[model samples]
Structures are given as structure tokens and as C-alpha cells.
Target: MMNIVQMGLGPIGQQLTRYLAEREGISIVGGIDPDPNKIGNDLGEHAGLQKIGVEIAPDLDSVALLDKADVAVITTLSSLKKVSPQIIEAAGHGLDIVSTCEELSHPWQTQPEVAKRIDEHCRKQAVSCLGTGVNPGFLMDYLPSVLTSVCQKIDKVKVERIQDAEPRRKPFRDKIGIGLTEAEFKAKRDSIRHVGVEESVRMIADAMNWQLSDVEETLELVKADRDLKNDRIDVDKGQVSGVKQVGRGYRDGKEVITLVFKAAAGVTHSHDTINISGTPTFTSTIDGGINGDIATSAITVNAICSVREAGAGLKTMLDIQVPAYFDEASP
Candidate 1:
């Protein structure tokens, strides 16, 4: 059985733990969380499951059973700088790692030096590390890049994801400013940076060997034109509902790749659409959209198998073999 350690017990982390508990050939060896309230709690209980005998530790070093772990799945935060220490600690312990850090998804574009360092460290440790999730790791970049493989000639790539925040988790709604005034939204907007669209853009551009002359990003407020009420929160008319952000990559002064993301409480359309203008132009749409939280956890867990099989170094979605559902029943 493959033993795994879960780092961070937030909503996403808890979800991943629960999912891993139900899977075969995988054992939850330990859990790491600094939250005092969560410390000492059974990992299964924290995930809303019956006790699985693993308690959450305040830190990796505190987990006496961590030696059994083959990999660490981290979902703590999005910042690469903030999460580097956790990653380094896990790597130091000689465990492979798969993190949901957005910036690390394709850090080479923005933090090349840090990426290089992490790659070197992981290489020396003889372990592999990867940063992946739904948007940056899959839909916007990986999925579109996969689609282009069949194209005889590729010119432009466009990906749009529209999400309705009404059914999303409270953290997601709050992050998108679902129920704030225009001024309140503006005030908190800077704190809510759209994590990985630019990374996704660059990933695609780099995959196609397109030298981007410029990359641009724009954010706009999605105001509530009418009153809206959801399970989590309420929004009065004229209040800020969410945001629509666009990121573009240009080559030779022409936009070669464009990514559009819109998330709000009352969005009528909810789907992921990709348009590729190539030799044989084609478009693909996933109806009802991909659930962000669920998909993030799914991809992270699925990546564990890939990371274990990959070579020792800092890896990305592009580097590892395509991930698929791991079936225990398979020979």
C-alpha cells in the first residue's frame, strides 16, 4: 500500500483526506495542521469520517509515524514563498510531494529562480515535487494543450471558465467578493489576486514555443444589478457580486493566447469553454463546469500516483504522465 501524509486540514485538505481514506492501495499515515483546535483530532473525524487512528500533528516533525509516508499532499496556501518551507521540510524528510499551490503550478514563468532552487533541492533529495490543480494544471493549460496536439497548425488559443458562486463553498464565495459593496469589493480585491491564469497562459505559450512579447491581465467587478440571495450570503442591488478577469499572452504584438474567467453569485452561464483557432478549428465545452474544490482535491490525489512514478526533481503537470483514476481492482 502507498502511505501518504496530508498537510493542511482546511476544506480542501479535509476533502482530500476523506477521499483518500475511501480509496484502495493507499493509507493515510499522518496529517499536519498547525490549527490548535484541529490538533490531536483523529484525521478521519476531522474529515467527517469515523476515526481512522491517525491524529493531526501540529507539524511534520511532530508526526512520529511520518517515516512510513511515501508522499505528502499539501493544500495549505497559494503563495509559493509562504509554502516553500513546508515543501522543503517534506522534501528533507525524503518524501515525494504534490501541492496545490497555484504559483507553483508553473512557477518557471514568474519565479524561475525559486523553481530552479526547488528543483535542485528535490533532485538532491531523490524525491519528486509537483504543483497542480484544476485551472492552471488542467482546464486552462493542460487540457487546451492536449487539444492542440492534433492540430496541424495552431494560431490562437482561448479558454473561458464561468462559475456560479451560489453553489460554491463559503471560502470561494468570500474570495470572489460575492456579497460586498463596490467599495468593499475594491478594498478587498487586491488581497484576492487571481492566482494562476497568467501561469496557464505562459504554460500554453511555452508548450507551443511562442515567444510572448507581452502578457496582460485585467480585472473587472461584477456588480449585482438586482438583489440576490444564496444559501451562504445575500447581495443587495448595486452590491458587488464577483469579478471577470482576462489574461492575454501576445507574440509579435498579436494576442496568441487568451484566458477569461468569470465568477459571481448570479452568473447564468456556468461552463468551461475552449476555442482553438488552428488548421482545423475546434471548440470543447464541459457542461455545468468543473467543481473547483472537488476537482482540485481529485487532481491532487490522482497526481500522487504520478509523482511516485516520475523521476526525482521538481515536476509540473506538463512533465508527468497524464493522470487517470487509479483503480485498485486493476491487476
Candidate 2:
């Protein structure tokens, strides 16, 4: 059986625990979270499952059976800098790691030194570490790269993901600046926008061996046409109801990769569209789009075994085989 330690018990983490519980051959050995409310609670119960034996501890050090785990699934924070220490600590305890931190998806372009440190440390600890999620991990970067494999030549690539925020969870609503005024949204653009567009651009460029001259990421607020209210938040007419963030990768002043992310309170017919320009160009679209939360949790759990079997080092989705849903039992 593959023993696992879960770090971060937030919405996504909880979803992961519930998914792990349904699978056989995998045991959730322990859980760690600093939240006072969750520190002593049963991990399974907190995840909306019947009480299981594993209780959440305040930290990894508090999980006395840490050594029994073969891997760690982390969904704590989006910033790689803030989460790097936890990664090193987990690796030191001999656990292969799979994290949902966006910035770590592909850090070489912006945080090379820290990425290097992580790679070196993980190598020394003889454990592998990877960062992944739905957007930066799959749809925007890795998936586009994979699609390019069939193309004999490629020129430009465009990807657009549009979703309705009304049906999303509170955290998703909050992250996309759902109910802020136009001025407030403009002032906090840098802090409020999605975190990994540039990283996704970098990953695709690396995959295609493109020498990008410049890469740019920008976010614009989508004002509410009229008053909008959802279970999560309220938006006044003319207030920022959503966001339109675009990331572009330029090769010698020519745009080669374009990624557009749009989410709003009432976007109808949510979908993901990818178009490629090449010797034999094509376009692919998912009718309803992939659910970010569910896909993130599924991919994170699906990747646990891949991380364990991977070579020791800091890795990205590109460094391993594709992850997918599975069914099997263990001893």
C-alpha cells in the first residue's frame, strides 16, 4: 500500500482526501494544517467523509507516523517562495512531493535560484517533487505542448478558457475579484490576478524550443452590466464582476503563444478553446470546460504514484508521464 501524508486541508486539499479515501491501495496516513479549527479534527470528517482514523495535526512534525508515508500531496499556497521551505522539510522526511502551487509549475523564468535550490535539495534527499494543477499544469501549457506533437511545424498557438463564477466555490469567486469596484480591482491588479500565466507560457516555449524574446501577462476587470448576486458574493452594476487576463509569449516580436483566461458572474456556455497555426492547423474545444477544482484535486492525486516512481529532483508535469483517473486495489 502507498501511505500518503496530506499537507494543507483547504477546499482543494479536502477534495483530494475524499478522492484518496475512495481508492484502494492508498492509505492517508496523516494530515497537517496550521488552522486551529482543523488541527485536531479527523481528516476524513473534515473532508465531508465519515470519521477515519487519521486526525489532522498542526504540522508535519506533529504527524508522528510521517516516516510511513511514501509521498506528500500539498495544496497550501500559490507562491512557490512561501511553500519552498515546506517542500524541503517534506523531502527531508523522505517523501516524494506533488504540490498545487502555481508559481512552482515552471519557475525557471522568474525564480531560477530558488528552483535550483529546490532541485538540489530534493536530489540530495533522494525524493522527487513536482507542481501541477488544471490551468498552468494541463490546459494552458502541457496540453498545448502535447497537441503540438502531431504537427510537423507550428507557427502560433491560442488558448482561451471562459467560465461562469456564479456556480463556483467561494474561494474561486474571491480569487477572480468577483465583487470589487472598478477602482479597487484596478489598484490590486497585480495581487488579485491569476498567478501562473507567465509560467504556462514559459513551459510551452520550452517544450517547443522557442526562444521567446518577451512574455507579458495582464489582467482587466469585467464590469457587471447590472447588479449581480450569487451565493458567494454580490456585485453592483458597473462593479468588477470578473476578470480577463491575457498572457502572451513573443518570438522576435511575433506572438507565438496566447493564453486568455476569462471568468465572470454570468458567462454562459463556459468552454475551453485551443487553436493552433501550423503546417496542418487545427482547433479543439471542450464544450462545458474542465472544472478547475475537481480537475486539480484529481490530477494531484493521480500524480502521486508518478512522483514516487520519478527520478529524484524538482520536476514539472513535463518531466513525467501524463496522469489520469484509475482503479485498483493494494495489499
Candidate 3:
């Protein structure tokens, strides 16, 4: 079995622990989270499973026998600044890594220096590190890249991921600016908007040899037509219900890739769509969109083996075997 350690205990992290526990090929050896509420708690308790022997530690320095673990599954902050230290520490222990940090999906295009540092460490230690999640890692970026393989001549690629925010966790809902005043939403636009739009656009373009001059992104709050509330938060009528964020990537000043992410409460339709403009143009859609939380956890767990076998450096979905659920205890 692959020994794994969990590196966060937030909403996504807890779900990841649950998924990891369910996978037969993996063993949870430890967990780390700085949250005072989580430290000392049973790992299984946090995951809503029966008690497992592992208890949450406060940091990587505290995870006993951390060097013996095969992988560190990080479901943590989106910012590379905050997550970089964890990456470095894990690499020092010679552990492969799989994470849900949005920026990590394809940081070569955005934060090359930080990416280089992490890459260098993983390479020196002979391990691998990857950042992945539903939107950036797959639907908007990797999936479209795969679709283009069937086209002879490529022109443009567009993807739409429209989601209903009501079903999402409170953390996700807050990340999209739900339950805020118009001013509050706009103020946190740059900070709270989905973290990986530009990265997603650039990953596809770079893979296709479509050099981009620049990438542009815009964010606007979706107003709640009616009152919307879940167990975690509330949104009043005419207040901010969600966020509408769009990202455009241009090559030679021409828009070659466009990604539209619309997530709001009371959304009439929820779907993931990809349209490729080429000689053999095609459109693909998934009704009722992929649930982000569950998919992120599943992909991270499934990708563990892929990361361990990948080149000793930073990787994206483009660089590794396609990650999917597997029942075998060994690969």
C-alpha cells in the first residue's frame, strides 16, 4: 500500500481524507493542519469515518515518520506563497506530492521562479509534485487539450463551467463571493476570484504552440434574485449571490482561448461545456457539472501513483498519465 499523509484539514482536506481512507491502495499515516481546532483530533473523526490511529499534527515538522510516507496530499491555500514552504518541506523528506492548490496546476506560465524551486527540489530528491483540481486541472485546460488531439487544424477553444453555488460548501461559496454586498464582492474580486483562470488558459495555449501575448480576466458578482441560504451562509435578495468570472487568452493579440465560469445561487442550468474550433470542430458537454469538492479529492487520490512514477519534478495533468479511479491495490 502507498503510505500517504494529509497536509490540510479544511473543507476540501477533510473530504480528501475521507476519499483516501476509502481507497484500498492507500494508507493514511498522518495529517497536518495549523487550525487549533483540528490539531490532536482523530484523522478518521475529521473525515467522518470511524476512528483511525492517526491524529492531526500542527505542521509538517510535527508529522511523525513523515519521511517514510510515500506522498503528501495537500488540500490547502490557493496562493503559491503560502503553499510553497509545504512543498519544499515535503520534498525534503523525499515524498511525492499531489495538491488541490489552483495555481499549482500550471505555475510554469505564471510563477516560474517558485515553480522552478519546487521542481528543483523534487528532482534532486527523486520525487514528483503536482497541483490539480476539477476546473483548472481538467475541464477548462486538460480536457480541451485532449480534445484538440482529434483536430487537424485548430483555431479556437472555449469552455464553460456553470455551477450552482447552493450545493457547494461554505468555503467554496465564500470564495465565489456569495452573501456579500456589492461593494464587498468587488473589493475582494482579485483576491477571492477563482485562482487559476490564467493558468488554465496558458497551459492549453503553451501545449498547442499557440504563444500568448497576454491573458485577461474579469470578475463580477452575481446578484441574488431571491434569498439564498445554505447551512453555512445566507444571501439576501438583491445582494451578491455568486460570481461571474471570465478569462481570455490571446495569441498575437488575437483571442485563441476563452473560459467562462459562472457560479451562482438559483442557477437554472448547471453544466460543463467545451467547444473547439478547428477543421473537425466539436462540442462536448456534461449536464449538471462535475462537483468540484468530490472530484478534486478523487483526482488527487487517483493521481498519487501517477505522481510517484512521473518525472522527478513539478507536473501538470498534461505531463502525467490520466488519473481515474482504480480498484487494484497495486499498479
lDDT string for model 3 (41-148, tens) is 999998898999899999887888676688999888899878999999888888889989899999997999999999998899998999998878988999999999
Candidate 3 local Cα displacement, residue 331, angstroms: 6.5
lDDT tens per residue, model 2, 169-286 = 7887888888888778777777787789999999999998898999998888898888887566688898888889999999999999999999898787899999989978999999
TM-score of each model, in listed order: 0.97, 0.97, 0.97
**Per-candidate RMSD, Å:** 1.4, 1.2, 1.3
Off by over 4 Å in 2: 329-331
- Tell me the TM-score of model 1: 0.97
Clashes of 1: 0
- Candidate achieving higher lDDT, 1 or 3: 1
Off by over 4 Å in 3: 229-233
lDDT of model number 2: 0.90
Candidate 3's displacement at residue 223, Å, is 0.9
Candidates 2 and 3 compared: the better one by lDDT is 2
Question: Ten residues in a row with the worst lDDT in model 3?
Answer: 322-331
